[model samples]
Target chain A: MEKPVVDQAEALRKRAASRRRRRILLYVAAVLAAFYSFWPVMVMGLEGYNIDLGVIIAGEAFKTTTLYIGGLPVNVKAIIPTAYYYLQDLGLEAYPRLVANTLIVAGLSIGLSLAVGIPVAYVLARIEVRGRSLISYLLLALRTMSQFVVIVPLYIAYSRLGLYDTFTGIALAEQLIILAVVVWMLRGFFSDIPRDIYEAATVFGKNEWQVFRRVVFPMVIPGVVVTTMFALVLLWNEFLIADTLTGVATRTAMVGVWEGMSINQLSFNALAWDSLNAAGFLAYIPAIVVVLLIRRYLARGFSLGAAR
Target chain B: MGAETRQGRRARESRRWYLLFIPLFVVVGFVEIYPLIESLYISLTNLNGGASLSNYVTMVTTPTFWNALNISLLYSLSSTILAVLIGIGLTFILTQELKGKGIFEAIYILPLAAAPIVVGVLYSPSSVWDDIQQFFHFILHQPYFNELTPSFYFPVMFFSDAWEWSPLIMLVALSIVNSASKEVYEAAELHGASALQKFRMVTLPAVFRSPVMQFVVVLRFIDAMRAFEVPLAWTNWLGYTNTLGSPVDTISLYLYKLLYSSSLGFPLGVVSAVAVSLFVVTLVGALVLLRLMKAVGG
Candidate 1:
């Protein structure tokens, strides 16, 4: 009780040091996080190097998913459950068609995203007409909802329209999901076109359509490239819709991973962990490299669009 | 040619060009608008194949629904806070004018191209990260995770989810901070402001909304709530991961069940009610968030 020293400065230093450590942890976490998230690309490498990896992976998938009843483990013979699979018996094993079909769906989504996205963006951004705010908000809200909301209604609607399990239906669904993003991003470009240039073009006796082709269209080329690349990267990673919408021969890359997971039981060892990990990596490699190539938009500062 | 007639001819041509937008609207309306409205209608009526108010009533009182709501809330809140902290922290460091900022940025967006399902698997502690954790198993045995036994695996998943999105948050925060006027910072420095003082008064007050910027990072979390692929694939819709909203059971998942099982007498009325509730909750959240963005932006 005799001494009363208020060493406030010392306390401040400790707080500062601790705060610095916390920040360092986040930085370290970001770096390690990058590594951890991308670890699946390693699996894609494994597939490229060896054809036998499929059996090894399939064999491993079987071990993880096999269950026991009343403490007796299920036999491996029944674990694979389908011996009639000519690959499992006669043994050419890996299905190339599975990979190709998924690529078809992904390709269609990219095409439609750009094809439709380019024009809607031009109109929304340049026209500046009625209901623009509402349109922008609609775009924002649509992107936020998961595809789960639309699955049943769309399934019913598609069945009515004869779209179930067809490539056209899946591509249409993919474009629907990504349309809002494309429009939102593209509108910014459209609005950024200087009005005076359009006015100058119109003064030359060029009509509105001529002005669009001559002035505004040429100005937003960079925006088109950025949006197209970004759209491709996003559409490629889409999984939930692809999982529910496609069927046997039409299944996409992500659905292949999902189907593989459905077959795997989580409780086991070297096999379950490695093979699924491998398949997931295979699905992610192309997507990762493409995005990294055009990362500027990914890093660009928050741009106020007067829209979002 | 008469001038008025020429203008009229041009106007007709312009209108035709606008008609090109019709196909775009068709795709948008067919895929986006109609299905959205159909879902809204489905959410209103009890959807158990035969039709009745009973499924909606049961859903309103269901404990599982409450758990999903709570899990979503926890995920949104904690994940939002962690994202903001990670974002603001790294962005603060980036503000130091470091040389490798461009490379640092590339590293951050790499995960955007990654599939959520793949992220889910990499985060699957048993398979992808166990090798890393085997190293940690020696130093600190995580007993706090023992309460759920199976959740012992959750730490890795949590880290993975946080890792995947932290860069996104960082990128957003960096944008706002970088846009701040340098004059204000110079004035603070001349006044002998400590680094912390510069951060508090000069930084936070000037760019008061960086935290909200970081929160937009959770748009993915909201999206994740209904995404069944990863949670279903990893947890197999188990009691712990989606106990509140099991795979095929969350309002979103329930919609899928109702759609596919409509043949099996799935309730359309219940599906519709839950879907409507999800739409309303999301609409309200979006409105609140927008309002907040405007306020803080000012």
Candidate 2:
């Protein structure tokens, strides 16, 4: 008996060492690969910082043949040189409006999503619903369908309903992709909490709404923020829907980049390259800000398949 | 405490909880199921390109669907394996007591956050990656990089995407790896066990079945394969933009054009069918891969 126990201990000990070494190696590999992936944007960012930003913006303006940013040539060209162009650029209809447009869409999408997600999540977390497994997995299945696959039908459907080219259209479309995911992630987090917490709420005379607002909401706040970040980035960066559902009037940053590239009329100078990079670099800011703000949410589970 | 009152109270509780599902049911029914059903109706009908799915059926039955589907499968499998292998590698690296670990993690996760289309635009196959492509071209003595031909294009794309998403896989794996017990390692060392043997016997058995952890890693690259934006955009960035806007295009891109077309040539019926098929595959792939990864370790 002692020999068998000793042998088991020895075998377990050996395995632990190998696992630690392997884990160490894995982290090193991740760090290096991460540096490699980020190198391009770093280069783009540095290029914009060292050179004339206005010229860069100007270069993109005239450079891409397909970029139909403005009907007026002067309007496109003159806006690049202002001293406060980055923030001021937003107001020019071409830049700031698009930024604001993206924000508005992101805000509305997050709002609409939470309105539905919280209740669904609350039930999944707290209630003993029938068909729970079926419901949970079905939502996952619906969400697993890539956004591109469904964009066309939704676009055509929305267009038919005259909701095409609108924020509501895209927000509704996004629900198809991320809403279920948010619920799934939050449900996992919510489920882990002891039911006795809710029982205690009941003993304290808290109604469902009061319990949710006071007890559940604060505990899940981190998850919600992270979920919102995921939702924001998903809607902000989604391409198929943007390309099909909305036109230039409501072009998101991605559309701006796509429309620019498709037009491709660069003047072969550093300025054009810089502006192109600037726009591309600026395009990443919303994603960066959202993730950084809710870095905790991004740090864990909601992103396993998509958020990562 | 009577049976009748108890049953009635249980019924009342359920009704309240069930009401919460109203929003879920409505959203799922409209946004997800409706379009899916509508797409099924389109796939079977004959309403595209001056003909019905006769035109559509011919196209669906053509060698193209099989070919693209094969490419998608290849892309997904290849990327998934790459992400997993690379993810595990990075997890090993992350376990080291290295400086700047936080920065490294941030760098690794950036791609997961950025939209694929934007990646496509940045890495645009049309004219994107020319700088890096030119380097590889010089090394291999291939002239294809200069003109950005199809033969030279796909390799560059594969390199760019793998580079983009592989870090994410590692982050997922590392999260699991990080949570592992340290005392287990000290015990193994005290017994004088070897490093490779320790991992083989202990670490693999423990974390391998972690579904939330593994799914988070593998699910990403599988999703990457269905991607229309990133590969197409990067190829175009190299200057042959709009090359993929074709009937024989990616299933998603194909559906995209059909929906947005000015000519109304699309079979809405066929598009819906494709969407349904898309939903099924996404679900199945996630399930299958989840099972496969566990089997690989278990």
TM-scores of chain A across candidates = 0.66, 0.71
> What is the clash tally of candidate 1?
19
Reference-based lDDT, residue B249, model 2? 47
For candidate 2, what is the DockQ-based docking class? acceptable
Q: Identify the candidate with maximal lDDT.
A: 2
Where model 1 places Cα greater than 4 Å from the true spot, the runs are A1-99, A267-269, A299-308, B1-21, B40-52, B139-159, B192-201, B205-221, B224-230, B237-266, B288-298
lDDT of 1 by residue, B146-252 (tens): 31233543343344556566666666655566677889889988998755677777666544445345336435456545554444434552543323345223344
Error of 2 at A232 (Å): 1.6
Candidate 1 lDDT by residue in tens digits, A1-308? 42333456667788899878866765675566455434544433343232223344334433444434335575553234222222221232333455676667767876787687677677765554455456555655666655655766888887788888899899899875667766756766776678787778888999767877777878888877777666666666776677777777577766676566555644443443335545555566677787787665664312223212
Estimate, for each residue in A1-308, the C-alpha lDDT of model 2 and write its tens digit. Answer: 69999999999999899877767776656656766667666655543343333224333434422312334333333223332323333445587677777777778777887899888887877877887767756675665676655565676788799888788876777676578767766776676578899899989999889998899889988777777777887778777666667775666777776565455533234334445556667888778777666554563544433222
lDDT of 2 by residue, B223-279 (tens): 765676644553333443333333224555444544555364444555455555666
Sliding window of 10 residues with minimal summed lDDT for model 2 chain B: B239-248
Model 2 reaches an interface RMSD of 5.9
